[model samples]
Target: MDSLYLLLPVSVLLVLALIGVFAWAVNAGQFDDLDREGWRVLEGGEEAPTATKAQQAGVPLDPGQL
Candidate 1:
């Protein structure tokens, strides 16, 4: 019962803190370019040019394999 009191307040505070930070980020236009980021991933625009070249060259990379 004593631990419940401590844990509840801590959990509520953590959730409220996350909500506050998310609200601040939304107010600061952090979500403005959300669609562009997702679209870039689908369009493969986020890939490195050198990686594409290496793929075309048939030269296998060690850790940067496409």
Candidate 2:
């Protein structure tokens, strides 16, 4: 009976804390782009930019050409 008094309030507080966090997240737009993130993972990642002329011509960009 004594443990019940302690445990019940703790459990209720925990539930309320979780609900508060969820409400804050919703208000902060955390879930606004739900679909965009999922689709981004499905699509291929961005490609690297192409190399410059010096790189393609095999010319050393620094002092050492060979």
Candidate 3:
């Protein structure tokens, strides 16, 4: 029963820390493009707008590369 007193506060602090990290990520735009990478992989190595990231990074994508 005494352990519960410590465990409850620790668990609550863990939950709050996780929530803070998630909030920081959201504010930092980490979740802004969740499906973008999935679509890029699904689109395959074939050339397409999948190179948008590379293009934005000023790196050119070859005609046959993802």
Candidate whose lDDT is highest: 2
Could you tell me every candidate's TM-score relative to the true structure?
A: 0.54, 0.64, 0.61
Cα displacement (angstroms), candidate 2, residue 18, comes to 0.6
Tens digit per residue, CA lDDT, model 2, 1-66: 999999999999999999999999999999988799889889857996888898999977886654
lDDT of 3 by residue, 1-66 (tens): 999999999999999999999999999999999999999988788645554676889987787884
All candidates' lDDT scores?
A: 0.86, 0.91, 0.90
Model 1 lDDT per residue over 12-63, tens place? 9999999999999999999888799888778885646664676789977888
Error of 2 at 66 (Å): 31
State the TM-score for model 1.
Answer: 0.54
Which of the predicted structures, 1 or 3, would earn the higher TM-score when compared with the native?
3
The model with the greater TM-score, 2 or 3, is 2
RMSD of 1: 5.2
Q: Pull out the clashing pairs in model 2.
A: none
- Top of the candidates by TM-score: 2
